[model samples]
Target chain A: MPDVIQIKAFGMIAEAIGSDSLEIENPGTSLALKKQLEAQFPGLKSMKFSLAVDKKMIQEDTDISQGKEIALLPPFSGG
Target chain B: MDRFERQVILPGFGPEGQGKLKQSSVLVIGAGGLGCPVLLYLAAAGVGKIGVVDGDVVSLSNLNRQVLFGEKDLRKNKAETAVRYFQDKYSDIQWEIFPEFITVENAQELILGYDLVIDGSDNFPTRYLVNDACVLMEKPLVFGAIYQHEGQVSVFNHGPNSCNYRDLYPQMPSAKEIPNCSETGVLGVLPGIIGNLMALESIKVLSGFGKPLKNKVLFFNSLTSQTYEVEISANSDSKSSIPETWKDFEQMDYELACEGIKQLSWNEAMKLMGHDVAFVDVREPGELPPLECTGLMKVPFSTLSSQLDRFEDAEEVLFFCQSGIRSQKAAQQLQQVYPDKKIFSIRGGINALKS
Candidate 1:
């Protein structure tokens, strides 16, 4: 069985991806996951968001474990 | 019977906590949605002094979330009105008003006077400007922002070891890709929830009672009524990206820095309107109060793709919508097709000119 990771998107990221949460095949690394998501959602290509793996913001390309919950958090401009 | 008797009586947050709050001053940068509740609670909680800085005047549309203003307050400077309201109805906390936005020129001077800052600014430029200024000045910052149903709250620069906003999102998202509150729309209560949390964090940071959101960014979804947080570690690259000195900071141009697609002010856009320059209004066909400009093309963003042939001869194209959100999208889309043409989006669009 292909390992799957759960992704939670917030704000405009959620709107662009069409859903707040989704399941995708584990992309192994944080950078790969970002590329995969961007390839699927053209709207996200220009947008900037922080990827959090297991509730920790990832600064570098870190391996993502199977079944982990990853969050896509974007900075909000509105007050 | 003291006015702070209720809060002062709580265990672990007694006389000492009250005293701490009574001595700390906070500068709130924006008197809009989030600032209203933050200022209201901070003043009620007996913060020693509060400074309200906002260059915007209270328009009729601001009445929904900016509860500090009334019909009589419309057209008055937001900072001035907020200060006046607090002075008339709230505690004896000393109130200071800037009646201006926190620009780089005044950011250092403004932040230097306060111990902490609460950023409720609406745009990325101001947010980044405020964050860098607070980090440079070495002040604790309570940050809150809302977009539609979701909100984010964080405490940055709380200590030497704490992470700031730069560590969370290392790069500022291009202004072209993002829309403002007016463009996307927001629930009236979203800012209320986020702003109250910011106020709570301010009190926590000031009194040293509960754990502040230091090194943590809280994400709240009002739709699900759930809260989640991401642990922040100081990214060395992000930390180093901040300008080292006041001279370097003053030279920073936040607006241009955040712009991926070149953005022109109304005045700048007007200067290039004629000749081979094409001015495109990308708002909907019937958006409102038509833009009466010389040689302007009415190309709604929805139909921009099929109208590319219309701009075949133009050397430069400028896009503008009601508030410049859709125009930015249009400019980005067109820039991809015509890589050699100079495509720009007019900042703030027609609504900005109206205001």
Candidate 2:
């Protein structure tokens, strides 16, 4: 059985995925989540963003447990 | 009687805190939406010295958020105009005005003169350049940026366990990958709010009155009134990218470093219409009013790889799409195949030609 986690998308990520928040089966790791999300939304494949778990940004692959607060944060370039 | 009597009376931020602000200097880059509020508040807060750096001219569209500029200020240099206007209002504060954008050549020297830096720049190249320079110079940087209805604020390169902007997201997205406020449109209030938060952070960093956003980034959404903070950790990969010496720093080409490809306007593209250039439209087949130009070909981006041979005989290739975004991607893709070839993308694509 796969763990279900809450995902919060911000900025362009939200626009690309067409939602600000959603729930999906956990991909188990940060890198996997990025790959799965990119494959799921082709629009995201070309963009750059960082993934955070429970409010801490992960620079490398990290395990994801059920109900972890996963957030997709994209950098805003405008002033 | 102290001019800052009200602020000087605050509990933790009393005479000492006011003194810190009165002795500190800050360099503000870009005097647009975000810089206006930051400049005004910093001056009002009694900062000792302030420098304004902006190369752009005041346009009619800027009046909404760039409150410092008026109709009379139109067509005037932003940095000079803003500095003079605020200088008139606050004669006590010393001012440094640079009516030019910050470039790699001047970044280090310009930043070395100030104790702190505030980046209100609107583009990715300048943001990365400023962040790297701040990190290298060991100066505290107050950073703020806005999108359509959201904004981000953070204080970088401060405190013991400092984390810079690159630690949050190591790679700078290619130009046009994420649309800026000008392209996507922003509510004037969004930057105003973000800029205020940035100004507050700058004060905190300088006066040591409050806990600054060290190792953390604050994100705000105006439409939903939602706010969240993300903790950042130092990444060696990001730190390694910063130049260790002045020579290396000066040699860095920020424009090419940010993947900023050559983009031409409709008039410029039209000039080469009948020349030895191959104009390729990367839009999908049957996609609304097709572009009609001399020596034009339709090659959808989805099948671009399979159609590479179609442009083998052309001296140069120009790409266009519905909105110029995809066309940039197409140009980048083609350039990878023909590194020495002159490849260009039309800005705003067909929509630009029509409107």
Candidate 3:
């Protein structure tokens, strides 16, 4: 049994993901989740954006097995 | 008992801080949503001189967030309007106005004169250009951006090892990838919130009261009421991308750098109707006014990637959204998938088809 994570997308990332948020089986660490998402969305793989878990931008492969809120923040060009 | 008595009472922000603010000059780019508040707060703070650079006009839609203008000021130039408003309220400070867009031709002159540059620009090319200019000129830039319900605030080029916009994200994405305010729409209060933060950073940097958001990017989500502070590490190599020579900087291809996907008019789309091409309706299902064509099919841009197999029969594809913005994004994505195939987005989308 795996924890279900709610991956919330923003701006263009939402357009890439189709839905604002998707519940997916927790793939473990932040890096693993990104790999899972990239595999599901090839377009997302090449897209230049950052992933934030629990409202913090992750630079390292932090763990996310608790199924917390993950936000895909694309660079906002609007003001 | 004076006009500035209220704010001067704060311990850390005393008469000396006020004096520093009264002696500093700040240049604000883009007098739209973010610029309005940044200008207003910096003006009220009694900054010695403030330069406003914008070529946009006040329209009915701007009233929702650009608080400087009222219904009466509609159609007036934003730079001119802002100068008038600030000069009227705070006559102590000098309001410098540049009633034109900051391009590669004029940006250097406009930016270098001011001690601090506050970027409220609305597009990626301008944003990156500003960052490059700030890096080259060694001017501190207070940056802000807004999306639907979220906003980002950062201080770039202000201190040693400080991360500029390019340091965070090195290259500019295609224009089709970014959704401007006109295309995706932004919350009225989001820019205000972020602009105020920008102003706060400017004051902090000017007065030396507190630490500015030098290398950190602040992200805010209005709906969730959540705030995230992302620490951006300075990439020493990022500065290398900025043109070393004036000639190189002048030759930078910003327009081609921010190029959009190819667009097709209704006539062109109609011409391709009889051919073996996939006419994609990127709009969500049940969108009004059905598109009657020989090979029209519904494949919303969002779900299009998942259902690419549906369009396997066609050698080419043409995507159309409600207003043409999303379709451009769809076509750009498909173009990457099938680089050899001809892919286009219908100009003005189905709305143009109606007319």
Which candidate wins on lDDT? 1
lDDT computed for candidate 3: 0.81
lDDT of 2 at B131: 91
Specify the CAPRI tier of model 2: medium
**TM-score of candidate 2 versus the correct structure, residues matched by position:** 0.82
Candidate 2, superposed: residue stretches over 4 Å from native: B260-339, B343-355
What are the per-residue Cα lDDT tens digits for candidate 1 across B1-355? 8889999999999999999999999999999999999999999999999999986777778888888999998667888889988888765789899976687789988989899999998988888999999989899999999888999999999987989999998988865566778777777788999999999999999999999999999999999999999998777789787898999999887865786577777878878877899988888877777877668889989889999888889999999987666887788888888889999988767765654
What would the per-residue lDDT of candidate 2 be over residues B1-355, giving only the tens digit for each residue? 8678999999999999999999999999999999999998999999999999987777678999999999998767888999999878977899999976788878987899999999999878789899989988899999999989899999999956799989988987876688787678888999999999999999999999989999999999999999999998888799788888778888876656777577776778878765678989999999766767666799999999898878887888889987566787888888888888888888657655644
- Candidate closer to the true structure by lDDT (higher is better), 1 or 2: 1
lDDT of 1 by residue, A12-48 (tens): 9999999999999999999999999999999999899
Q: List where candidate 1 sits over 4 angstroms from the true fold.
A: B261-355
Ranking by TM-score: 1, 2, 3
Give the interface RMSD values of the models in order. Answer: 0.8, 0.7, 2.4
What tens-digit string does per-residue lDDT give for candidate 3 at B188-253?
888899999999999999999998988888878888887777677655667788888666787875
Tens-digit per-residue lDDT, A1-79, candidate 2: 5579999999999999999999999888888888999899999999999888999988888999888989999999998
Between candidates 1 and 2, the TM-score winner: 1
- Model 1 clashing residue pairs (backbone): none
Worst 10 residues of 2 chain B by lDDT: B346-355
lDDT of each: 0.88, 0.87, 0.81
